[model samples]
Target: MYGHDNKQFFGNNKLLLPEQPVHDDFLDTMEKVFHWSCIFGVFGSKRYISILWSALILASLVVIEYLAIWKVIRAVTGVARDTSGHRSITARLAGTIFYSISIMSLFVASKLWYYWRSNISLLWAKVERSVGVKVPADSTLKRRLYLVFGLMTFCSMFEHTVSMIASVGLDCPSSLLMKRYVLVSHGFLFMGQDYSEWFAMPLILISTLASLLWNFQDQLIVLISIGLTSRYYRLNGFVAKLCELEKHQTEFNKKSEALKVYTWRKIREAYVKQAMLVRRMDGALGGIVMLSCSCNFYFICLQMFLGITQGLSTDVMTGIYYVVSLAWLCTRVISVVLSASGVNTHSKTALKYLYTYETHCYNVEVGRLQDQLTKDYIALSGMGFFYLNKTILLQMAGAIITYELILIQFDGQGQIDTETTPSIHLNVTNI
Candidate 1:
């Protein structure tokens, strides 16, 4: 099927290193982590240590949550009320869902890496080794990814550290048990048990720190995947430039019919090869994009709800920090969608350029390739459910706005009800 021509077009497949090896190397490392085997491998190497870490984190959060609800809130309000129905449940639910999706995304990303690793050698072998075509350096994309990674890391650390400190300083009744600050508190877990702050705080700190690192790594995997799309965009641009040149050459040299025919064939081959590579990679990422988009949207919506309902006046600095962290997270999802959309747009542009000129000699082949391009444009879907692109952000925006409006109406009605209720007076409450 044009085996020799494939070799001639792609040149030395063994030497298909990109101009930006560092970025490529970084992506390679991330791919290794994204593999599904790494999950079991962590248990194999660390075994009980990893289990202990998870247990400690869970325990700390539970204790903290219990104290915050039962001890602190009860003492302040002078009522033995159960805070189980607090709005924080929304956040907890979102976190749990996102964490599960994050784990699933790892598997998806791993499969993507596996697919790419299997086909990358063949893809490189088919790449047209043209001296005239310049491989663009994609250092800018790499830099932006790292910058986002850094922001995510910084925000996570800041949020956890401040929360930990605030938890410790929270005043509670002398009779209250579990006298330590924690990331969260659970009521049922502490119903019959008493634990020392000594045993809890250290575990909480270690678990919280581990969770932060884990989340950061997960996000890095996503960014790496997006970076590949960015690379695809650049490659598509290169092909488009080549097509433009071919169009001009055909316009000027009418006698060079054979040359024009061969050039168009090579261009078609290039497009086909690029499409195969991008399609396989994007397909592998299908589950990841679907899960991530759904989880991130819900997570962001929960954050906005909490931020709006939980008054900033309670702790001005803390509120601002929390809001900022939410903003950074929202940015990550937006960046990924935009990058995916960019890849699709570039591919369509290349297809348009391919059909921009027609040669009398290779008219049949050109038309065939053009038809294929129209049908085979690279698109990433959310696990066969929906297409993931810029429109995802718009959908999320609409949902968030609708939910906020509903929350506002409820809050106004609640305030009116409170104004009409009678107040109970406590006698000899203070010395």
Candidate 2:
């Protein structure tokens, strides 16, 4: 029932095909190949490896900082109960030294990684343009890649060392108190259980260490997914441009038909064929968007559920996490709405441009139409859509404010060591 003949009867000059096609398997394979290629291409690059390493180092630094803070809290709480105070002082000093080293290493590693990635990507883009081909799988690229990997490994080593030192300095009582607060507060609001009570300090310590190790990998996966989605959008844009060019050629040929019918007709047919190819390319890109959206939506839902279920209901900690999560969700929704609107606007403008091209042909003055089309494209692409960007910025600002409010409500109250009353005798004399 889905046929081109049916499409021809109506004003729908657009090609019609069944949603489920015989080439579905082939299309799926191609899409997978595209994703894997992009992943490997980026990962195989020296720059990306450096970045990955730097990210790991940063994660390590975060862990080290947490440990150092834990140690300091223990000392303040007298959890170690060292009567001499010598052990506490030594642990604090050691933790501070290691944390400082980790922080400095992380900073240097991040800068180096950024510089390397940017420079390498720039060089590769130029080389690809010059060669008129995709980047080569070359020995030089591999060598550079190895160098980046080695650098990243070295940076990670320092961070790991800091984490190890911090681990050794952890005090049982301070750890228990911190765990109780975090678990009773965050867990009750989000996780629904006090992990500190359910699990002993040693088990909690092990779990924390495991989480630190795994969280970086999870973050990397997220980053990679985002990068792939961006690439899909860019590729779709290019394909759309090609389609517009072909449509332009077809219109030029139709107009020339008045003078030279046969020659112009052939040229128009060629353009139409090219346009069809571009349409197919555009269709392929739709799959990418669908997949990316599904993944993002899943993440959004999971995070929202966790935040609401565990975080909001907690009595001990103020509802800062809940507020931040809510704001983030709102920000994400706004971004999605903006992106969808932009894409729809782009599609409409493209169709309009095509219609104008077909109807006006060579006799039509296209400069004004082209200008309008360009403006529409710019607006639809959301490249300069500051409003949506600002929405996210404001949401983050709100999150910070909410966090501060929570802190002030919970921890900012002044301590009263003693109570005072007015002298009764003085008051009686005044009366």
Which candidate wins on TM-score?
1
Worst 10 residues of 2 by lDDT: 422-431
- For model 1, how does the per-residue alpha-carbon lDDT over 253-343 read when each residue is reduced to its tens digit? 4434444455556556656766766666556666666666766666565556555665354455446544564775577677666766665
> Which 10-residue span in candidate 1 carries the lowest summed lDDT?
422-431
Question: Model 1 off-target regions past 4 Å?
Answer: 1-151, 159-180, 183-193, 197-225, 247-256, 355-364, 410-431
Across 1-431, the per-residue lDDT of candidate 2 in tens digits comes to 22232222212311211122222222233233223322211122245664574455456546645754665576567774431321243334333443343344334323322432455334323322332111112223223333433443343333333322222233436645545333321221112242445433433343333222222222222222232223223333433443344344422333333432332332233233323332332232333233323333433433343344334453322234334434544443444434434433433343343444444333322334344335432211122322222244355446555654553444335221111100000000000
Question: By TM-score, how accurate is candidate 1?
Answer: 0.65
Please list the C-alpha lDDT of all candidates, in the order they appear: 0.49, 0.33
TM-score of each: 0.65, 0.28
